[model samples]
Target: MPPPLTTTTTTFLLLITASLLLTITTSQDSDPDSDCTNKWIHIRQLPPQFNLDLLTNCSEYPLYDNFCPYTSNHGLGQKTHNNSHSWYRTDPFMLELIFHRRILEYPCLTSDPNLAKAIYLPYYSGIDSIKYLFGPEYNFSSQHGLDLFHYLSKTDTPSIWKRNFGHDHFLVMARPAWDFSQPISNDPPLFGTSFLELPQFFNVTALTLESRAYPWQEQAIPYPTSFHPPNLAYLESWINRVRRSRRNTLMLFVGGGGISANPNIRRSIRLECENSTSLSTHETGYGKLCEFVDCSNGICEHDPIKFMKPMLQASFCLQPPGDTPTRRSTFDGFLSGCIPVFFEEMSGKRQYNWHLPEAEYGEFSVFIPKEDVVFKGVRIVDVLMSIPRVEVRRMREKVLEMMPRVMYRKHGSSLGLRSKKDAFDIAIEETLQKIKSRVEEFAAQ
Candidate 1:
């Protein structure tokens, strides 16, 4: 070894080493492409009416009362005071805004459409259609629908369309697919516009909350829940809390009946809950059947804590099909780490293929057919009781693991814990892969 250096020389060498390390770390952090791979996406620069207009007219947005509070934190919604940790009550329909914002802020986003692997059309079709359809003026709905179709048809460049006939492009609708594909009959019911019916959208992939059963083009995504964590620490803490939290109730059915066209199924579920509560004194020790609120009266709790309380404290959360086959509550159940019991396939099985694990049926959730619950005289409580405690724990763990994938963290959030991929990240990856596969298939032909 060399002779020991003087104090001044040693200090200078140590400082030089530290400075070099800092420089390298700073360069990595400041690099725009550090987090992004080669998959670059191009977002169409559409008129402000498509995206920005929705936020600009937030107060006039349909269900403005519910949409306004959840607009902050990059559409992650407002924070709750009930919990010590960071939790939000983000609106499910605000996904359009979140997706648009995330794509614009994406590290892999390219201004040149020529270099993009996939094209994202940032249109607020869900809110736009809802505004016209929900209004008293029916003709406005029809005219608005016509105008949207015309706009898309006229504005699309020949070069873009010729590339793959819009196969590489995608649109994200925050509402169900049915909301945009209204029947165009002789006497069509004016429920929604026929945006999806337009020929220009035929080859395009649609990312919607609910997809049609016949067509495979529409990919089902998770409805935004109220638990957007800022970072991995918050996410892990919440998951740990859920894992350790006492589940006092055996099962919970927290929705109203009489709202749907066929309310018999919902009615049956409510009746079962009532019956189970009344018979809790018997030997089965079925525990308690908790019904948080009556959603039929349109008085359901919007508070995140109130909504999650019953789900968190319950072993199984009843997930009956809502107005659509899927309900936002399904995601809420996943967030609470409560095992969800489904009555239909579309409710969870067919939907959320991108986010959920490719596990066999009943591996992570319970699937009690509606007929079994209604016609065959099977009880929800009896089916749940049949499962072993060990199995229930396993299923809950799987659900807890899925919590991160379903969550949409704050846009431009630091990628702390590289393994923790959020909804936006997953969507972008999937979209790019899909476009690549489709392009390859076309080339092969």
Candidate 2:
């Protein structure tokens, strides 16, 4: 027995509450821990961008995510991309987001009728998948997530894939049959067919990164379950905001993760150096096997974190793509306040994954192809001679200008999402929906 206006207000309030519940319920349909809040996820894969301190010295920083120690479980591209190799094999974890959720490991694939039907998971992340080594019927699609291979060339044929290749949206991972002599194109010897093609194909095509398009934009996806790691370091204030003081400095990149061990993989660096510039004594002697170099100034090692700390003190960092093009060292250099000197391979070889920030390699980073490098024209040494030391320093400053957006990591603004970064949140959410929709469509068959 309320007043008429009061009754109307109550009805309106109730309606709004009901509507909110419905919305949340829909969102929770895919995310069971939607309402639960906690410190952070443990057993999380740390992004390459994370410094070694945050990764290795978990005991030093109590404020960071202590629940999850950076273990081999989070090793990048190890288990998924190189399962056949005994040395590279690692424990499997769900690549997708897990919010205090139990991870189901598909270590061995046995065709059990009761086994939940295989879910098609597309890996758009630059890191290759180890699934190929297992030789399981995989569901693959250029339509789901980011497909770097298909993005390079339109009219890329999906038909060459084997029928049991699990064409729907998944395919088994196997070594590529093609040679590295050929670059990415719509032509035959599709790299996606097997793992062997992985080494031969570098991710350096620069098609999608230059085009500013995500691989999954054309497809429909489901709402991604928030990618919370089971354990992560406690959120620190330092991580909340990127350090702004450091700008354009010398960055000597060192990469030795799972990808560096492959003999077939080697980055061709293009630096702006004088033709007469010497290969830091180390390169001349060790060449590809070069580990660390003690120069007149300091030590140069193949450790990204070590390279970052000192390199950030200088105006430019020498960023060479790792053995394969999908190497993210260049991006990592940019995050450390060091401008990348991009060395594109004239061999038409592409290295590193797509989704790289677009900027003039010369302005912020220096891009030198392998042929030019050999010719000593735009070689790292040549550029160093052409520009004054002061000018080179200024170019490094330009890289610092764009640092905030370049580095990918969990920020203070993160809403419980880990493993999946905030920068990619919207894209990942859409990707999940597309994957779900595609999966449903395939199941209908």
Candidate 3:
């Protein structure tokens, strides 16, 4: 049986009291004669910003669907809910910039000359021509793709049909590389190893399997919404984290971040529920869901935020990054007061990944290494299973405390991309930096 919802308010109140108690108890225990400057600072003087109003929403994006009570369910290979357009067109400039940068960073162009020359063939095509090469498979409806094609094609045209198309210049050398069907085959031939082999050719390669973390995202984009309007109101059922725990119902968050697709991390999460019967999947894969949340025909009213709140109500939120550590699961889980158990160093070494949002993890997020979960010496499931009920409750409280600021509408907060630059500036900086550094290195030689 699930924990009673009646205990929610009490749990919330107790959490507030605990924070006060912790501060008071710590001060009383401190050495009065000690030089305070070198000691830990008291909580009161630390920062006024920590005082939290737990009633606010945690999602940066507001709901764009006109309908409510969206419950959608479809079997494998079918979307599990009503496909909302809101997640289709959120940030245009950022997407375009990322794509542009990616094209410029093509691996073949940077590392192999002949292969790079062969691949750069598409970019030289007429604007209309290149647009068609992208094909319909790309998320063209998204704000990013929308802006990209607008710049590539004139006056809203969507095809590359009118443009001159040829593969002969570079293709003759690249055709062997296209045989990706046989991974065991030898590496394709190249004219030279020089970084500038095809110096002028630019095209983004297909995202590797590892890069495509959010494979299920048919249309995972955000749409524009008025900054945090005053009308937002939703009931938050505060509950003791321990008392709220449920069995078998595995909470899952499939987002872009720390746990997305590292083989080790992915392997660990599977280990946790290796024996359990409860089943849950977060919006886009990671988050908490309310008892009422479900989908019908690829459509559901599962706003990532609202969905997370209820997910906390469950036993677990299975969180894996959509692509890397910068995935939105951190923001979603932290905002909804759900405990996010993670795999270690999700963003540490992978090149070209973004950073996780700034938030205290010890109190809300859980990090474990693959070694701890895999094999007989250590099991992630065993460690997770052993965590006491009371401890989990405390973690949940920490999550709830930060909910308001995590909401997408909250301007300038860590989770929000308030201005146009907030969304795309970092990507732009990285892109230009790489281009400049690469060009200079080649020139120097």
The clash count of every prediction, one per candidate, is 1, 73, 50
Q: Considering lDDT, which of the candidate structures 2 and 3 is the better prediction for this target?
A: 3
Q: Put down candidate 3 lDDT per residue, 95-144, tens digits, no spaces.
A: 22122222232211222222121222122111111122233312221221
Alpha-carbon runs more than 4 Å astray in model 1? 1-38, 61-66, 82-85, 140-158, 258-263, 281-286, 289-292, 443-445
- Between candidates 1 and 3, the one scoring higher on TM-score is 1
lDDT of each: 0.70, 0.31, 0.31
Model 2 C-alpha lDDT per residue in residues 22-121, reported as the tens digit of each score = 4334433433233222111111122222212222232233222221222233321122233222112211121221111111111212122112122222
Candidate 1 to truth, TM: 0.84
Q: Compared with the true structure, what per-residue lDDT tens digits does model 1 show for residues 81-144?
A: 6553466666778788777656655556665567667878878777777666765544444454
Task: Order the candidates by TM-score, highest first.
Answer: 1, 2, 3
Better of 2 and 3 by TM-score: 2
- Top-TM-score candidate index: 1
User: Worst 10-residue stretch by lDDT in candidate 2?
Assistant: 97-106
Which pairs clash (backbone N, Cα, C closer than 3 Å) in model 1?
88-226
